[model samples]
Target chain A: MSRIVLRNLVKSYPGGDRRATDEISLEVADGEFVVLVGPSGCGKTTLLRMVAGLETPDSGSVHIGDTDVTSLSARDRRVSMVFQSYAIFPHMKVRQNIGFGLMMRKVPRPEIDRRVADAAAMLDLSDYLDRFPSQLSGGQRQRVAVARAIVVDAGVLLMDEPLSNLDALLRLQFRAELKRIVHQIGTTTLYVTHDQAEAMSLGDRVAVMRDGRVAQIGGPLEVYDSPADRFVGSFLGAPPMNFFPALVSDGPALSVGALSIPAPSSLARFAGRTVLVGVRAEKLAVSTDAADGFLPATVEVVEPTGASVLLTVRLGDHELKVQAPPTFDTRPEASVWLRADPSTMRFYDPETSLALTV
Target chain B: MRRFALQVFCVAISLFMAAPIYLITLAAFSSRESLNEFPLPLVPTDPSTETLSGFLSSTGVIAGGVNSLMVGLNTVVLALLIGLPAGYAVARYAFRGRQPYQLFLLLTRALPIVVLSVPLARIFLTTGLYDTTYAVTLLHTALALPTTVLITAAVFVAVSPEQEEAAQIFGASPVQAFVRIVMPQALPGIAAAAVFTFVMSWNEVLGAAILTLNQRTLPAQVLSTLSFSPLAYRFAGGFALVVPALLFIAIMRKYLLNMWGTTLK
Candidate 1:
């Protein structure tokens, strides 16, 4: 039931060479699911570990509700974490592992039993209570790890890539199950992962990180549609947004490769500056003739997915991917025209990779 | 043709290793009059029970064996008590001077023991620890410590830190997490360390010879009495040495694979 806040937290290892977390500041509202997403080695996991008190921050403070727990040991933090490997005690039975936390606090034997049984039933681990972790399958071990955490009933839960070890099908299944469990408990949760889809589907709000800094923080769709910068746009989408190097023009059109694409009226001020155009694959329509916002492209390859066909086209030196319906026919070396609606195309400052207006 | 020769060469070397031990056992089982004959009797005409019974009946031989057992068990317990915590700290923590601590352990094993023997003898005499079974046990701890630390540290390293952290998050304190979560996983390693330490202490001759006189350990007793004592006593003592080492190796066979694997790494 506590809201957690981290202010200007910094964690650097000895020799000052590796900064595991650098100036990270975040807040999680009570009962909210806040996901921290980034590439590997991007410090998202480091930030979460600091919050759990597994790592000490070199600077700034971590506040759980009104208490500043910056210098507290992990045992004193009253926080639970689910590790990527699950880390269930291989020797102990599921019930003993689940009740370990209670036993440590010296809770009465009967009380520990009651709570452990309750947690097992909640996690659907009741049937496997007597089994050792080695005896269980990967998915069962994951549930036992969750059950161990739930038995503690900590106010906040920190999950570090908890589903990363599961197979794709299991990951999806557990992602939904985890959401339901977290929602049912209504505990404040901070989950860290490198997977964009995991962040999008599970997080109530997502914080996209790059180079140990949060690039953008917003609802999944908000960050996907209206990225704070070009990095966020490129990182969030699958098949990635296509980039075309273009020069700003005085009229309603800009020359890109060998074709002109419609420029929004707002770009009239920057006539000579170089700009990059972002066209999402699904937004680009392939046809025979040039249309209002069309650019001609020479098809390099047509890759078929069951649902959609992606046409990789050569536009001067740059390659652009155009998504078309599965029925669309275009062979290699074929000349095809692709168009994006003017409102859907994103613009970026080529020099800085920062998003530009219109 | 070359591979067949190499295999035969290895088998011949093994037999060379085994021949003297086999000859000694056969000679000890023979009677004193039969043993007097060199190059051995193909089958002793007068193999008798007198020599085996006489060796077993000797007070020094029996006392030395008992003392060796005590010293070995004591060394194992003492080494593990100190080594487990030191190993865990060295493996898991990143406090200042950690590299220096590791270097110090490596230095302990690197130096020749002969150089330390006289100085250690002087120190033990001043401390009133000379000529006692406990003194030999204490001396064996120094010999066992470095191996214990290295082996146990490797064991702890293999037990992931993330698991301990996960235990802490589940509400166990650092100490509790180590006891409940970490210890169970590293038990096989600790057992292996104990067995190694016991065998090292049991096999030691130099330290035991320098430390004790009346309560001499088995190897020290055997070495001192080797030329003077009857062949039967020497053979029985040798058998004792080989027997325990073989037993320990058998008991700790599983960890040998891991120990060698880790050593290779």
Candidate 2:
């Protein structure tokens, strides 16, 4: 296993204007599963492909350990990739597909068999060894793709949204299984996906990307708890973090519409300045009685999601969503009060979308 | 109800096509004693192999069939040799003048093969390759190339690039990836394209007749000897040509649906 480093990697199409991969840099430690996550066209996949050497960087260099691999071809780099469509050769049996790299290297038949069997066993694909890809289910085909990569014995593995094609249940199951398999092998992996859940679950560290650049790179929770900017914070969670246009009013409070929430005291120096206040739904509380820095509001909608209820409340023209116990039933026009756990409230400059010092 | 009507329409069309061939076979098989009979019989009173044998005995006719097979196989091999890599390059790579190269191929198809045969023959004679099998096969490429390139392009297109990319990532070079992954996936279509190439070469006459004299392909032989040729010999030669058409479709029946579907697009 070796660390992979990308430095100022840039890729622009021939005679084309936009940069597909901008001057971005990242590092994946030995045995680390680093996932690059973003929306489509954010250049996460392009960056991964460049590292695998399927794509050449217009400039900049990629290093595996201390070796510069910028000019290396994909085959020379010894980086295995599991593609989105599970590109198993249709004519080859599962075993042959898994053993292709070994065959190419002229590995002896018995060794190829042993490695194929080992990979098949690891991926639970041994029983389907003789079957073709067409005979396999989507999940099974994915396992075959994984087996093919693992059998190559390459130190680095790149996967581009490999689970995106599977159904929800299969994706979740394979997400767990993939982590277990990759962890056992300890190959350095660079995974790319647009799904935040997959990124959070699979990556030892996740790189959140936006507009062809790394917005932030940290342990999943670190990026989630303290995103570098508004985009990272907004992109890292489900139902997403809520942002309110507000002004940092006097007396440790930020006002949004007719509602005001207590701001941390450290932010008092920025009083009377326009700011953005963000809070995850889980951190906002709803109650019947108003408290200090809490606002009374009318509930507009209550959505029950089996385990929790999401209450959409109207506070003047601004709306806030609060996650509460499913049993905490409320109806439209019902009166409620909203409070932000001050410690969890994220503050940003409204104009620049940059996080505030506090 | 509408589907049944469509099925009937299709059967009607099939019979419409088969009817003439059926009448021709009947006429060709009828004995020489019945030659002047009018309102031709639907079936001959006695079918005999004599006509086919006599047709084979005709001057240079049988040899022409052998030449046709040689020329057709040669065309298939050469076209695939040149067109396969050209198709792959055009489909997978982007370089300067790639679109122009494609436009040039299309332009070749637009200019009639007949117009170029005279010029090509002169060049072949200069090269001292005239009247040889190589000359005939090379000339066929002019007719075979456009279809070969286009057909192989479609074949390569249907094969997803991700598969080849996956192979490269798994420590296989581009050539290895194409051979191990892309080519296998594209095989069925490639086979169909090869058949199309063979058919084009086999049926081509105007160019072959003008280009070669002593070494003539089936169509050239048929045309050269059509005047004063026995009726049985003409029909037998026609029958032999139709044999390849039948074999072509039969051999590719499984892939025909896909081939036709792609070609129509």
Candidate 3:
């Protein structure tokens, strides 16, 4: 029943040129998992630390379950965190690490043991409870950190790049386990990471941050399908969105070097002004044979990426990426044709870099 | 060739360090008649306790031993009490003058102990602590603090601040987190500092001789009297001084070894 609400949070580090987190406000519904994803120094981690009471904002009010806890220290707040390095005490065995929060809370001995045993079983660490962190593998250590965080019954759980230290295969495997465990515990969470795939897979909703401000916040598929800005579109997907510089001509069509795209009515007012046309790499179709309305491109590189093939092609003077079936046979420097559905195209203002209304 | 050369170098260094202690022990325990023989045997051939027993039975030896042990142990405790916090602060915080403060600590040792001894003795004399073990203990603590602060600061820096933040977020107060998490991890460093302090205090003769007369510690007492004693008795005193430092290091070796295994995977 604990929901987190932040109001107008602004923070700046000493000697930093600009604010680390600008005037930003956000809310996470009860039991919701929200992830903050951005490039380095985008203020996503700073925003999460503010909520966790680890970093105090220059100006903000934090509310947990309707309680204004802006002045409370981290120990007084009902929050738990899993650090990037795990931060497990090397001297403490697994059981002690899991039970540390409970012990600090003055929970009874019997209850602490019961909860620790349950958490151990949940994390599949029962057999390793007596072993120290030095004896555990990286994945096991990460699981121990998760177990320690969840055993506290905190109102909110904060994590900062917790899975970024693991290997790729472990990260993929642990991603599902983490989402499932968080849902089962029903604790509100605010996770921060630079990895887009982790943000998409683990969060119920992703908040895309840029320059200390949230560029967009929406469901995973919603943000992926329609990004709010050029930055958001390019940041969220693999291969990113390929942008082509164009001009808005009559009929609100985009006029590039040799092609005219019929844009939506939103571009009608800027009919004579310049704009950028953005399309996802996966949205452009590749054809080996020539067809009408398909622009010819020179295949510069063919990358077979397990499930699909990504081809970098040169159309006119611009290079673009197109997704094709993995089995699609192709060779370097070969000629190919490409096309895209008009609805899949997004138009952006070049100056502001914001997505134009569609 | 390199491996063999390295092993030879290591053995050479070990023998260079161990030879003096072995020689003193042999000289201390040998019979008075046997010690008179020229080109003394490198090995223990005539083991006896005549000179050692005579030195032990001499006046004020046991009392000086007791005073030395008190001063050494007290120096270890006081130095750590004052130094550990300064170490943690220097490691964790970045307040103004931090770099200057560390430099200042190093500079304190740059002044020779002899120059500071007169002013230090005058201060103690004015405070009516001239002839007490407390004066020696205070002097030893001041001498030991720079090394203690630098070493423990390095250890605290190696200990992750994230662990302390995690503890605070988990419901422990700042003090409690330091006690439960930081202190245990800092033990090996503290032990190393203690070993250094104890040995320095135990062997320091100039300050102890100037500070105390009738209440002199073993080293100061030995220095005041050993020039007039026989050579065997001097060897006996050397044997006695070396044994305690060796024992203290032995007791602390466990924690010193714990330093390498302190990190999480």
Among these predictions, the greatest lDDT belongs to 3
lDDT tens digits, residues B1-265, model 1?
9999999999999899877767666666667767667766765567666666677687687888889999999999899989888888888778888888887888888766667677877887899888888888888898899889988988888788888888787667778888888888889988999989999998989878877788888888888888888777776667667767778888899896786576312
Candidate 3 residue B214 Cα shift, in angstroms, is: 2.5
lDDT of 2 by residue, A175-253 (tens): 9999999999999999999999999999999999988899899999988887778998889887677788788888978
For every model in order, the TM-score on chain A comes to 0.94, 0.96, 0.96
| Candidates 1 and 2 compared by TM-score, better number | 2
**Model 2 per-residue lDDT at A122:** 90
For candidate 3, write residues A316-355 as lDDT tens digits. 7788899998888889999998887878888888888888
Give fnat, all candidates.
0.79, 0.81, 0.93
Error of 3 at A276 (Å): 0.8
Which 10-residue span in candidate 2 chain A carries the lowest summed lDDT?
A: A254-263
> Mind giving the per-residue lDDT tens digits that candidate 2 earns over B1-265?
9999999999999999988777667656656546456755676776777777777787887789899999999999999999988887777777788878888888888877788888999999999888887888998986788778877887787778888888887767888888878877889989998998998899888889988999999899989989978776777777767767778888988886785565311
Q: Of the candidates numbered 1 and 3, which has the greater TM-score value?
A: 3
Top DockQ model: 3
Error of 3 at A219 (Å): 1.2
Which residue pairs overlap in candidate 1's backbone? none
Q: For model 2, report DockQ.
A: 0.76
lDDT of 1 by residue, A1-358 (tens): 8899999988886775767677888999998999999888788988998999988888989999889999888888888888888887888899988888888878999999999999889888999999888889999999988888877888898898999999999999989999999999988999999999999999999999987788899898888877777788778878777887788877967778556777788887778877888878898878967666667779999999989998889878888888889998889999988877777778888888888866
Q: Residue A288 of candidate 2: its Cα lDDT? A: 77
For all the predictions, what are the DockQ values?
0.70, 0.76, 0.86
DockQ of 3: 0.86
